[model samples]
Target chain A: MFYLLGLGILCIAFLFIIGLYNLDFKYLFMISAPAEKITAAVIIIGILNCIISILFFFGVGYLREAVKAFMEKKIFQLKTVLYFKRSGIYLSSCATLGFISRSLAIIYLRVDNNGSGFGLGYSSLLIFMLICGLCFILISHVLKESVALKEENDLTI
Target chain B: MSIYINLDKVLEDRDMKSHELAEKIGITRANLSILKTGKAKAVRFSTLEAICEVLDCQPGDILEYKAD
Candidate 1:
């Protein structure tokens, strides 16, 4: 629940930054500056960011449900496994979308002769997201094994 | 699937209730029910020993083999 609240705060802050402060992609999309380029690539990146945020939100919600089931001693149930699997997929989607968005941004910057400020930080962050996603998938497999073992134990008399 | 539990028959023959036998054997009613319903994957020898001791029956009398 705390994690959900934190994500909610983050999303609100992100929206405020984009709407009022006119952040990077938002400025590219909304500003009427003479030199501002409204390329299709930036629009795609914006869409990907929106998708990543929404996916994270839903994934967190599903995880909360899984935690609730765990507290109820339903750890080895099918629904728990499914919720983790879905969250894993959502995390992977976020990483993939971030990768595509960053790649497009790099290409756009290079084309516009503004490549001097491009850094490796965003790439490293995307890689971290990818690794986290793969770990979630691995955890789901472990949970599957646990479910099988639990069923066997339950049936043993 | 070939091995069959004769717990119900043995319990009936001894005029024993499921929960009563379960308590006498120091096992949970749910576990006893599982064994009686043949839903158990495998019965431990310790539990089998307890059941046989409490019900005054042999292991063979409680468990039987049936070719499927």
Candidate 2:
């Protein structure tokens, strides 16, 4: 995903360079200067979103494992685990918002450019972010439930 | 939910301290406390087996079921 984001950013930069040079294109889908600028901004936002999303993924994994270990009554190393889990939830939320904003920016640029068809770029990105958001929500719920179960078990034992 | 753990009775019968048992099992005293308090969600099969072997008792003698 990060690679895709980087590629998109590079594509936008190339477009901007071409636009600045006032290069004539025989290609059917040529973008103008203003449109290129907008695309570049969107791509930059997309890159940021990807970076956050990657971090969130690692965070979710760490949280899930910590929760599982906690449930198993492994309490020796809990403080750090709890910290990571909390931070992961916050990062995931931020990544979701970033992805949404980037997608909207891309859509706005497309419309401004008088691009006839809806491009696959923005729609795919929106879908990916939505899926990631849902996954993170599910992960949070699972971790919460696991923690509750561990507490209950501890109380009973 | 309330669960029953008979670890205290087994430890008493075996003449073992919580810290000593924890040291033998290679787990922390806090974890042993959690197990004794019945606050642990799950126990590993290996750990359970080790406890039973050390205490010369069955799992049924150490744990009992209770409804929430």
Top candidate on DockQ is 1
- Binned by DockQ into CAPRI classes (incorrect, acceptable, medium, high), candidate 2 is incorrect
Give the distance in Å from residue A128's predicted Cα in candidate 2 to where it truly belongs: 7.6
Candidate 1: clashing residue pairs, number: 0
Complex DockQ, candidate 1 = 0.81
- For lDDT, the strongest prediction is 1
The runs of at least 3 residues in candidate 1 whose Cα sits more than 4 Å from the true structure, single-residue gaps closed, are A1-36, A70-74, A109-120
C-alpha RMSD by candidate, in order: 5.1, 10.7
Range of the 10 consecutive residues with the lowest summed lDDT in candidate 2 chain A: A20-29
In candidate 1, the residue pairs with backbone N, CA or C atoms under 3 Å apart (3 or more residues apart, or in different chains) clash, namely: none
The Cα local distance difference test for each model comes to 0.71, 0.58
User: Worst lDDT window (10 residues) for model 1 chain B?
Assistant: B36-45
Q: In model 2, how large is the Cα lDDT of residue A128?
A: 48
lDDT of 2 by residue, A113-142 (tens): 222232334334334435544564565566
Model 1 CAPRI quality: high
